[model samples]
Target: MTGGPTLPALPPSLRAPLGLVAVLAALVVSVIGTLYAGHSQPGRVDRWIVSPTADPVGPPWRPVALTLDFLGEPAGSVLLVGVVVAVCLLLRRPRAAVLTVAGVALAVGTTTLLKQLVGRTIHGPDNLSYPSGHTTFFTALGLALALLATDRLGLGRTAGTSLVLCVALLAGAAMGWAEVALGAHYPTDALGGWCTALAVVPATAWLVDRAADRLESAGRPEPR
Candidate 1:
């Protein structure tokens, strides 16, 4: 409680936890916006990035999602985290490894819960199908990357860290877009994904980061 490893920021301190909560608050805005703007289905926010396969018969969201597909598969966003963790584990970063694995679980589990609890049917509206799972994974992975890639991982600024971030965002966006392209998810699904991610991802990441920080701080002896 006093001090612990933080998520995305050093934990052991209140600032980091507060910052994470604030960041997650963005999800609320996203959800509310989706409820208001979405016509019980995904809307055409072509202003933002979408897919390209928007044919006359298909859900317009498909083209929007397809358009957002970059580097092909949506897994691009999380691949960076895997690589980072691989390097970290090889380099002897136990904390980063645990957080990466746990974050993935947390993100995926939460998404499944949302899909079910929200009752957002697939293919069409009638349910809360605004948020996209692809988007959830994408955003969740990004949060994990930001949280897990700390001093323990040894990701130097001049080295792979920067590249990892760039790839993560681009990939997540692409994957999220792809959902719409396939007509599997609505545009709002992507939005809900982001909101859910921002809300839960940060909280879990912060909790995990605090645990790591606690261990780290414990290693340092106090000056008697």
Candidate 2:
């Protein structure tokens, strides 16, 4: 269902540039993924960020990390999405609700598929971890929220773009840190996951708007 005042379309001036950035971000995920494919060891880049031998997160911060990690899990993700969708509907922002679910789902799905293709393992051969799905989910969620806020506030181009990037960056960094600290993924894997969301969400938002517009147009009565 189309919501009143649909998710604000990215300003026309920003769309082309953002689209290009999305493509480049996606390529970054691909190139790094290919280099590490079928390998379990951390690469030179990963080694530069955090030692492969560092101890897992402990006591004070472990719970915090686990809490963030849990939010990325299936049950937690569902709960989070449900709440967001419910709020969107309450506010008569059904388009925002749809984008929330669709964008996050597409971003996470991209990581899942890439994991299979990249075959980058972390702890063992069976555990694929090229792009971190957890990082993607949080990043996508942040982007969706930022977009909704931007539209609701009628933010200008510079302000809106800044808000969207800042929110997504913070969300991605928070989840990425949790994943790396817990030794679930290499630093590069988290980076790839962050890029995957950056690549997917905007594109998904644009598509959702286009699809909704077309559907609404089709349902409109023709002039007499």
Candidate 3:
């Protein structure tokens, strides 16, 4: 933990563009991957992503499998809610916090509705599995955190933050991959989740921050 050399931080303005690019790429990949997996080889991909294939002699679960189950499950949302609440309290941005919570609800609800509306089968089981829940959760979390990190880093050097944001977003994608890899969902399902995250994360970040200080005069509070 202590051995890594300190990395110079990059500027947020530069980092923001890169982050946007990454998000766009992830969304694209997720979309294509999902569509291909479900539409072309649903049975095969489903088996690959869903069916358990562990060592014959050892335990039934791999670490990755266990980890996926833990994060992708419904319970993760409660934990996410807790984190958001804590972060909002810490930042003293109640409205932004409220927006984040609302965003999550809307995201999850929309995902569910879309899944049903799309009538995309869950592949192996009777489950409705478009838009991997874990992927969405992680994407949303990463987007929020990335925005927060960028704000803190400002328009100055933030290579350190950049690295951190990369890892965070990748981790979220990894979770989605796990779901798809395990056949719990299709790649498109994950992609859909990622898309939802992208569509709203920036807006939520703005909501959380409200108006920039530039809008109001420096010396006076606008209102009570």
> Using alpha carbons, what is the TM-score of model 3?
0.62
Rank candidates, TM-score, best first. 2, 3, 1
Write down the worst ten-residue block by lDDT for model 2: 5-14
By summed lDDT, the worst window of 10 consecutive residues in model 1 runs over 1-10
Off by over 4 Å in 1: 1-26, 33-40, 43-53, 56-84, 124-130, 147-169, 213-224
lDDT tens digits by residue: candidate 3, 94-146 = 44455557656666666676566555565443576666666777776665555
The per-model lDDT (C-alpha) reads 0.55, 0.87, 0.56
TM-score of 2: 0.94
> How big is the positional error of residue 100 in model 1, measured in Å on the Cα after superposition?
1.0
**Candidate 2's residue-wise lDDT over 155-211, tens digit each?**
777787788889989999999999999999998999999999999988987888788
- Residue pair clashes in candidate 2: none
The C-alpha TM-scores of every prediction are 0.59, 0.94, 0.62
